[model samples]
Target: MKFLLIGQGLAGTLMGFRLERAGHQVEYVDAPEQTAASAVAAGIINPITGRRFVKSWRIDELIPAARLLYTELEDFLGVSLWHPQPLIRTLYNRGDLNDWQARSADPGYSEYMEDEPATGRLPELTQPVFAYAGVRHAARVDVATMVAAFREKLIAEGRLTSGVFAYDQVPALLGADAGARNGNPAYDHIICCEGWRARFNPWFADLPHGGNKGEVLIVKTQAPLLNLMFKHRVFLVPLSDDTYWVGATSENQFSHEEPTAKNRTFLADRLAEVLTGTTYEIIDHRAAVRPTVKDRRMFLGTHPDWPQLHLFNGLGTKGASLAPCGSQWLADYLLAGKPLPEEVDIRRFNQPLR
Candidate 1:
């Protein structure tokens, strides 16, 4: 079957690859002005989350699937993108240390937690009054490179069109026989992966999209190169050379997508608390809106009224880990006859949306 994919962000890119691999043709249409959260994302996949240190939702399923998918894509793209790095979580206080020990004893955290706290791992870093713990099987993906390479490859293969997708033209363009093969290219279905911009999409505008603006910084630090991700409040992920991706300030309420001075100061103040011996220079700053849902779950499945229209978005901040499995599931449902898991299906919203 031939498919038309709107937006070449992480979700659409992954889904397009899956559909093509499954013996289907995919054509992509994306707007140049679209703010893709995937481009600026840190792509860090952490199993444990929050101050309470509870495991992420369905992390067991998400992490393993992510490992397999990224490893495969690494070989396919012939680029080094996926890096499995340990995460060193700093213990802020005695209470934090106690909670870590308690959770470590639980069998559920066996695969994710370290056997002991890494107290002396970084002597240079300010001696935490409490302690530090290591998380295993944590990793990062070079999302920006992956997205650019995929987009370029699609464009080269005559599968991508670069321009704004006028929604009004869609109905007239796809008239009569949905899959009819004519001189002009026609698609059997059009899947919307328009990220945060989906809130403006007439078809999916009603899906309760609560877009959050996130800001991150790329900095060159004099600190010694480390293979593990350092996290306290803000995460410092090592890239190549002496540069690291430092950031992510989550502002649920923001005026625009532009980087703000307030967030920059916030990140710098927090980063200073973690890096005692390291001198760093800010190299780049970026901001984008994450396609977060009000309920904090992914939005998936076809339009309620339009059978030929589908949506596969709302992976939010966890796009790297979520997209791998989510895209494959969407492809399977589209190509095969599998039913979408109830949790992610858009049908859960019973009220009419404006």
Candidate 2:
């Protein structure tokens, strides 16, 4: 079967990899500068979140498969992208500490959450941190390297187009009986994975795509606080020896995805207020809009009127964690004619968000 994937972000990359591995021919069209959310994202995949230290949405089912996925890709690309580092989650005050204790009492919570403290030569945090640090099993992938590797892999095999592609350039699917890529017609079974750019895709653009403009900073923090990616609304991911990624503000109604000095200052101020760390220098700054929905569930499944057409975006903040499982399910449904899991089914929008 011939599949046409729009953007080469995480979702598109994983889904396309699955399809291509299944012997389906895939030719992706990507506008790199315009569609590089994977490059800017601090792709941490911790299973615990929030002040209460609750488990992430689907950590149990997805966690096991995630390591294998990234490891396989890393070996294939010859670059280590995925990281299994601990996260030091600090408790700001008394109330937050109590909530963490109460939640930890539950068996469901204890497996993934803990009340450990910061150890080793780590700098003293202003607030006492009851850290739930662990190997987390999940790792942060170097999104840009993996994207470039896959893009090159696909292109070298004559499966990629490196140019801006307008929607009309996509030919329709050959017919219902056609295979995914090489076996059948492509124009018919197009799945739009354009990220925020999906708004411009004539076919799936009408779907509700609330935009979140996120700004991230690439900084050189000579302080080698390695072994984990730190997160507390803002993330300080260790990039190379002397680098860390401090990011991300969820701003709405932005005119463009370009980085703004105002947001850069805002991100710096936010990180500074949290931790008293070593002096840092901003190396690069970028911003991109995530194609999100009001409910935060991704838009995945065939279009209402066109079963052959599909959509995959809106992992929101958890694209790193969710895209692996979500894209696998999408590939399964697409190849085996199985139903999409209820969580991400596009038709479920008609049902009120619980």
Candidate 3:
């Protein structure tokens, strides 16, 4: 089927790639006037999170698919975008280490923790330091690189149109007689993947969403952290561009305004505590809201009124690990006439939307 995809962010890009690979033509419309949260994202994929250190939702099913997608796309684009790195989660205090040890005894953490040794190389803050291994299989994707690669292919295939999509322009239903859009009219169906802006989308305003804004920074470090991406309160991702990413602050309180100096300074100060002598340059600062569901689950599946008008969003803070699988699922459902798993279906919520 010929599909019209609004937005060229991670969700839309991946879905477009999947449909095209399945021999369905896809037309992607994403102008610079668009709001792309995927562009500003740090793209760190961690399977375990929080002080309790529990598994992420559906990590088992999600991680493998995401890796496969990255590999396939990297080969297709002739670019090295996915990085497998170590995640060193330092224990700020012995209490933190003790808490981790207790949690490690649970089967939930067995796969993620390899070693918990005393790495004295860290800062000797008031909180005693203990070194612990994080999910080494954790991955990071270069959002800019991946987006460029996908967008390049879309451009080459003549599937990309540069411009923002107003709510009214998106047809709310698929016409019955429409075949693949390449012949005459543009598309058989339209899937909106505009991230947090989905709140404003009349097509999906009823889909329960609690917009979540996050801020991130790119810093030029003298040398790579190379020790997997480190995390305490903040994350540090190494880039081929000789920069490290430190972020982020998940704020439900703020607007989707420009990245503020306040957030940059906050991240920088936190980063300084971790780096001993590495001089860094503050290269860039950015912010965007994740298309979060109020319940914190991914939002997918078709519209209540128009099944052909689908949606794929709500990755929240974990878009790197979530988008690939979510996109694939959406594409499979669209092309092969499969069902969207119940958990992510927007119908699960009760709302006319407040």
Candidate 4:
């Protein structure tokens, strides 16, 4: 089947990749000027989070699937995209350490949690903390590079159009009998992977899609910090050379998507507090709105009214680990008549979106 994908961000790119790999013809329409959150994301995949150190939802299944896909994409793209790095987070007090120990002892959590981690430069760079704990099976994905590479590939193959995709185009092309568009073959389905922007889609207007804006700063350190992903007050993820992806401030309430001076200062302050012994320069600051759902689950499935219209969104803050599996699930349901997990299916909403 042929598919028309809107937005070439992480979600759309991965979804398109999955479909094309399944022997379906896929095309993308994206506004290159729009700010995609995936472009600025740190792409840190942490298996454990929160003060209680609970495991991420469906992490065991999510990780293996993610590793398999990313590894496969690396071979297909001929680029190194996955970085297997451990994560070390500071423990603020005795209470935090005890919680970590308890979580680490659980059979389900043992493989992901480590009581002792190699500190490397953390001891020299950061202020004194109660302790530090390591997390295993963590990695950093170069989402920006991946998306950019895929965009180029799409352009080269004439599969992508670089322009804003107007929503009004949906209704005219919603069925198998729909006429060809712009002299191109009619698409079997029009999938919305537009991220935070999907809230504005008229067809899925009642799905309760939400957006959270995040700001991140890219800094170049005079000396190298720890190679592992580190979390102190905020996340400090290592990138290429002496640069690091430092950020981000999450704002559920925001008037605009531009990078603010307040958030930049806040992130810079935290970096200074953590990288105590080194000097660094803030090279860039960027912000984008992440597609969010009230229940913290991704949105997937066909529209209640128009069967040819579908949505694959709501990966939220964990897009790195979530997109691979989420896209695969969407593709499986689309291609093989498989059932979508109730938690993610759009039909979970009782009332049909008007």
Q: Pick the candidate with the highest lDDT.
A: 4
**Candidate 4, residue 276: how far the Cα is off, in Å:** 0.6
lDDT of 4 by residue, 181-209 (tens): 34433677999999999987887898989
The 10 consecutive residues of candidate 1 with the worst lDDT sum are 176-185
Q: Can you write out model 2's per-residue Cα lDDT over 231-304, one digit (the tens) per residue?
A: 66688777778788888888878887788889989998877775564567778888877677777778788765
Give me the runs in candidate 2 sitting further than 4 Å from their true place: 125-138, 169-188, 274-277, 350-354
TM-score per model over all chains: 0.93, 0.89, 0.89, 0.95
Off by over 4 Å in 3: 117-128, 176-185, 225-227, 351-354
Best by TM-score: 4
For candidate 3, lDDT tens digit of each residue in 115-172? Answer: 6533333333212345555564678888778888888888898888887677665443
Model 3: residue 301 alpha-carbon error in angstroms: 1.3
Q: Positional deviation of 106 in candidate 3, in angstroms? A: 1.8
Badly placed stretches (over 4 Å) of model 1 are 115-121, 126-129, 176-185, 351-354
Error of 4 at 311 (Å): 0.3
Scored by CA lDDT, what does every candidate get?
A: 0.82, 0.74, 0.75, 0.89
Kindly list the per-residue Cα lDDT of model 1 for residues 1-354, writing each as its tens digit: 888899998888888888888888899999857678988998999898888888888888988888888777778777888899888888888888889889977879977887464544464754454567888878998888888888888888999999978887555445533434344537778899999988888878777887889999888867555667888788988888688898899988888899988888888888787777667898888999999988778988887766778999898889988898898788878888688777788878853332
Clashes of each: 0, 12, 2, 0
